[model samples]
Every structure is written in structure tokens, then in C-alpha cells.
Target chain A: SQELEQSPQSLIVQEGKNLTINCTSSKTLYGLYWYKQKYGEGLIFLMMLQKGGEEKSHEKITAKLDEKKQQSSLHITASQPSHAGIYLCGAGRGGGADGLTFGKGTHLIIQP
Target chain B: GAGVSQSPSNKVTEKGKDVELRCDPISGHTALYWYRQSLGQGLEFLIYFQGNSAPDKSGLPSDRFSAERTGGSVSTLTIQRTQQEDSAVYLCASSLWAQGEQYFGPGTRLTVT
Candidate 1:
């Protein structure tokens, strides 16, 4: 089974500051997904990275998959209160039909 | 268009009782998934359904857990003789294809007391 470990299990950052969350996998990553979840709510898809060295960005958030495909990072620029939540990283190996293994998630706290 | 919908947003059941959680995927989606998230824990894969193919039940935690997708649309996850450990949020997701991006539903919060 593949395992994903996220660094800085919990983080507190000032609004408008930049922060980065890291996800490391125990095995080669075939598909990496980033999602955000508000307290007690469902997860919202943020981005998906498949190829090694792939990077994708949406608005103030950017995600990058390392060339080794064993680690990924999510960086937030000029964070806001809305960014405060749980950020989770999920990985899938082989085919897409396979269920994803997820990290425990990083709890982000943005202080205004 | 609707993403995914789940019934009984919150359910409270007693130990030794059975519970059923329903999930309605997006229209025309061929892939549906069930995941459980316990407090302070990450999402755990429960099952996967793609088109008419047999569901992938590999992720099920135990034989007490089972699910069914009727007409390849709606899915129901049944937990028999629920225990306190069964308390968690059950989320449903759907994607246009097996490899496509998945959209999740609000999830059903089950609390077994």
C-alpha cells in the first residue's frame, strides 16, 4: 500500500503571507491530487498532477510534482482567510479506477 | 449542473444497528466512489464503481461493509451492526470517466452511539 505523509501537520500564517505544504509519498506517484476541505464539509478539488515535474496553478495557489514523482508541494501566495482549512493530498497508482490513498492533511490557519 | 448529492446529511445510529447511506452521482457520470473520513484522519477509500463493471471493493474495511450501485446511477453503502468506530463522514464522488476529475458531494455524517 502507498502512504502519503504531509509536513507541518498544522500551520498558522498571517494573511497575505506565503506558505507551502509538502506531500511525500512512499512509492512512485502516478496521479497526485490536491483538495481543500472546510471544517465538517466535503473536499473541493484544487489541482491534479500526473507527469513528473508537472506544475499547475489556479489563482493564488500553485502545485508542483517533483521530477522523482515521489513528492509534491502546494504553495499559496498572499493567502486569505478563505485559504484557512484542511489541505489534503491524494495519490493513485496504475489505472484511474483505483482508489486514491490520502495524506492526513495539513491544517492551515490564516490570521487576519 | 449538479455535482453529487448524498442523502441524510447527518445520521445518528445506535450500536448494533444498521445504516444505509445513499449517494446520487452527477448525470451521465460513469464513475462513482465512496470514501470515509474519520475525525482527525485522512479520507479512506471505501469502494469504486465504473460503468457496468464489477465494483472494486478492495478498500472496504470489513465484510460488515458493502455497497451497491443500482442502474449504474445511484449508490447505497450499507454498514451492518455499526460500531462506535464506524462513526465518520461518508463522502460520494463522481467523474465523467474513470480517470477524470472527481467532484464530491456534501457527505453523510454518521455517528454511532
Candidate 2:
């Protein structure tokens, strides 16, 4: 029952390598957000994008939303060991009943 | 206080037994949500509560699954007549408003034997 599909379910990279994860939805997106969760821990809010084609950045990570509003991508530059975790993209319909509709998530592993 | 917290990080129960999971949201957070994550699957919406008003129970998978939020703060999810299919990680999240950034708890891993 997941409307969003994340590609490359798992990624393994060298410590300093760069990588990208993609999230595509079957429905038009109103609000898109990213979260990261370490094993056995709670999810940490990463970023939120409202407008289509908008881009946001935090540290070495940059996120971009598609103009069609049905897709988004999270890019990690110079990935670090601390960046290893499960990255999840969630979409909301943007209304009174809006709650996060999450993807299966992409697990990233950074090796030194 | 500082973040959303869930009680009993892990719970083990036998089939036909009942179980309850608790979630405490950050003060002043108006929106609370419950979700279930099956092993190797995406999170499925369970319920949504805002303030003291009626909650959105559209996501309840079965009659045995129910939840209540008291005074717009603490909430509990009750599972009755538990089955093996009920085993999953139950997660709780709270936000100041709908579609806003949500704060999640550690989640309770429920195992039914």
C-alpha cells in the first residue's frame, strides 16, 4: 500500500564517495520530507520541500524535488561514516488529515 | 519533554493475549499519529489524533486494533486477540500541525509467539 517507490534499496560506498537515492511517487506530491534513522533509533527529521523544483541543502546533503511533483532525490556528497543509516522519504497530501506516507527506505552504508 | 517517547521498547506476547503500547508526545504538539512497520516493509498508517477532537481511524487494519489519546497528550494503542500477523514495530509520532515535521519515538517491537 505504498504510493512511493525508492530505488536502490541498499547502497554501499567508500568513505569519501558520493551517492544519490531516488524516491518516486504514483500520486502528485504536496509536501515531501526526508528522515534518517540509525539502527534501533528513532527517525531524525532531515528536510522538507513544498514547491516543485525546489531544492534544499543541509551540510553535505542536498535534496531536490521534481517539477512534476511526483519525485524527489537525496544526494550525499563526500559521504562519511556517520551518514550510514536508513533514509526515508515521506509525502503528505497537505491537509487536515495529512500524515506521513513513507517509502520502504534506502539503507546506506559508508565504509572507511 | 525534549522529544516524543514510547514506553516498553520491546514487548513479547503469546497469541490470543492482549497488549498495550504507550506514546507521550512533546508538549503543545497538536497532531499525533500511529504507524506500523512490518519487517522489510514501508510504514503503514494506523491512526491520527489532533487535539481532543475525533481521531481519524480510517487506517485501523482490523476491529482488534484501537487507540486513544487522552487530554491531547499521552496516547495508547491496544491490540486485542493478538495474532502472529500482529508482530511488527509499532511507531508513534507527534507534530505541531498536520504535514509538519514529525518527531518519532524509539518504537515498540512487538513479538507474538
Candidate 3:
């Protein structure tokens, strides 16, 4: 089973709308990375959160990690067409692992 | 190179044949990773190599899959006795250190018949 679980597998919203995506983990998240992927391209790193109750923002996007370290949420304000892509959340196994555990992902589409 | 480069941008192979995929990471990077994305599915970890130490192969799906780093710079992923289920987009990423953020490549699309 996936260690990281993402909610709302797919979402469609109109341009300029506000949206939020959630990621939950069975184990505490040592590192949380949010990436956006344009169709057929490599992942474009958005932000990384390490400490519990951490928050980071990039342009119109903001992400927050809960104090328990088991969940995180990404919020997008005044969305744009360029923001349409697959959003992925990945969690570390608290270090000493080969790689990060990635969630299935949330596919978001912004309509004009 | 400026970013990780993967070759044979696309590959089409037959079942039971062996296939090799190559990756060249950004210069001076010490950590490398291999992942596979299967037909709209999330990326799956395959192997990880850090510095000159032995690679961590725990994520390999089966014995049919193996990877090697020649000089802590370039790496190759080989799949033997390929099955149709092995088709996917193979991605490579490199980080400056063992626990740093990673930069990914464009990926190689593999199609097995």
C-alpha cells in the first residue's frame, strides 16, 4: 500500500478559483515535497517542508504541514491555466531509506 | 550537464529481450535515483545510489531488474526477460547530497511488447 495517500484523485476548476489538495501519511513525514508536472514532462519542484507545523509559499501557492506531521495541504489562489497539471506529494520514511515514498497524485485541471 | 539526461528518449522492445537505460546526472551530485511511472500511475522507486557506497536495491520489483553506477557519475538500469507489464516511463534524479532536494530528468519511455 502507498505510505502517502492523496485525496480527490481528479479535480476541475475554473480559472481564478481557489483550490486545495490534501496528502496524508500512515507514518510521520520526515520530509514533504510538493511538485507539479506538466503533461509528459519532468516534475517541477514547488516546495519542501521538513519541520512539523511548517508552512511555505511560492507565488500563488501555499502549503502547510500539520503539527502531528502526518498530513499536509496545498492551497492555490487565483489559479491560472498554467497551473493545470498533476500535483504530487511525496514523504520520506523518516530517513535511512533508499528513496522517498510518493502518493498516487492529484490531477488538477483549470478551465478557462 | 545542466540537468539529468536520459537516453534513447524512447524505446520499443519485445518480450523476453533485455533492455538497458542510461542516465547522466548533474555534475558533482552524490545521490541518484531511478523511478518508473506506469501508464498514469504515480512514480515507483526502483533503485538508489549514493556516493561510492553500495547502492540500495530494496525497491527493485524483482530479480529481473538491476542497476549499476560505474564511477559515481553515470548509471544504467537493465531489465532482463522483459514482460509487457514492464512498460513505463523511467525517470532519473540526482541530488547534491544524500538528503538534499532532487532534480529530475525528462525520462525515457519504454514500451515492451
Candidate 4:
């Protein structure tokens, strides 16, 4: 079984500041996904990274997969209150039918 | 187009009772998944259903947990003789294909008291 460890289990940042959340996997990642969840709600898909050294950005958020494929990071630029939530990283096996292995998630608190 | 949808947004049942959670995937999606998220914890994989193949129940916590997908569209997860540990949010997700990005539903919050 693969395990994912996320750093800084909880973080408090000022609005408009930058912050990064890291996810390290115990095995090589075939597919890495980032999702955001509001308190007591379902997850919202953020981005997916497959290949090593892959980086994808949407608006103020960017996600990168390291060349080793065992580590990934989510960076937020000029964060807002909307970015305050739980960010989870999930890893999937190469096989199409396998379920994802998720990290404990990082709780982000954006102070206005 | 609608994403995944789940029934009984919130359910409260006795500890020894059985409960069923229903999930309706997006139209034309061939892959559906069930995950459990307990309070102060991460999401745990429960099962996976792709097309017509047998479901992957490898992630089920125990024999008391079982799920079935009917007509390759709607899925129902049944927990028998639920315990307090069974309290959590059951989320349903669907992807166009097995390896595609998954879209999640609002989830069913089950409280076993």
C-alpha cells in the first residue's frame, strides 16, 4: 500500500501572502491529484499531474510534480479567504481501475 | 451537465441498524467510486466500479460493508449492523473513464449513534 505524507498539517497565513503545501509519497506516483474541500462538504477537483516535472496552474494556484515523481507541491499566490480549507493530495496506481491513496490533508487558514 | 449526485444528504441511524447510501453518477460515465471521510481524517477508498467488470472491494474495511452498482449507472453502498465507528461522510465520484479526473458528489453524512 502506498502512503502519502503532507507537511504542515495546519497553516495560518495572511491574505495576499504566498504559501506552499507539500505531499511526499512512499512510492513512485503514477497520477497525483489535488483537491480542495470546504468544511463538511464534498471535494472540488483542483489539478492533476502525471508526468515527472509536470506543473499546472489555474488562476493563482499552481501544482508541480517533482522529477522523482515521489513528491508534489501546491503553491498559492496572493491567497484569499476562499483558499482557506482542507487541501488533500491523492495518488493513483498506474492501473486504471485502482482507487486513490490520499494524504491526511493540510488545513489552510487565511486571515484577512 | 450534472455531476454526481447522492441521496439522503444526512442520515442518522441506530448503531445496530442497517443503512443504504445511493449514488447516481454523471451520464455516460463508466467509472464510479466510493470513499469515506471520517471527522478529522482523510478520505479512505471504499470501492471502485468500472464499466461491466467486477467491482474492486479491496478497500472495504470489513465484511459488513458492501456496495453494488446496478445497470452500470446507480450505485448503492450498504452497511450492515453499523457501529459508531461507521459514522462518517460517504462520498461518490464519477469519471468519464477509469483513469480520468473524478468529479465528486455532495456526499451522504451518516451518523451511527
Cα deviation of A58, candidate 1, in Å: 0.4
Interface RMSD in Å per candidate, to 1 decimal? Answer: 1.1, 1.1, 1.2, 1.0
In angstroms, give how far residue B72 of model 1 lies from its true place: 0.8
Instruction: Give a tens-digit lDDT track for model 1, residues B1-113.
Output: 88799999999999999999999999999999999999766699999999999999988999999999999999999999999999999999998987777889999999999
Q: What residue runs in model 2 are displaced by over 4 Å at the alpha carbon?
A: A93-96
For candidate 2, what is the DockQ? 0.80
* Per-residue lDDT of model 3, residues B1-113, tens digit only: 48999997999999999999999999999999999988666798889999999999988999999999989999999999999999999999998987778888899999998
Per-candidate RMSD, Å: 1.3, 1.6, 1.5, 1.3
**Residue B46 lDDT, candidate 1, scale 0-100:** 91
* lDDT (tens digit, per residue) of candidate 3 on A43-71: 87898898888999999999999848489
Which is the better candidate, 1 or 3, if ranked by DockQ? 1
lDDT of 1 at B28: 99
Model 1 residue B39 distance off true place after TM-score fit, in angstroms: 2.3
Decide which is better by DockQ, 1 or 2: 2
lDDT of each: 0.92, 0.90, 0.89, 0.93
| Ranking 1 against 3 by lDDT, winner | 1
Clashes of each: 0, 0, 0, 0
Best by lDDT: 4
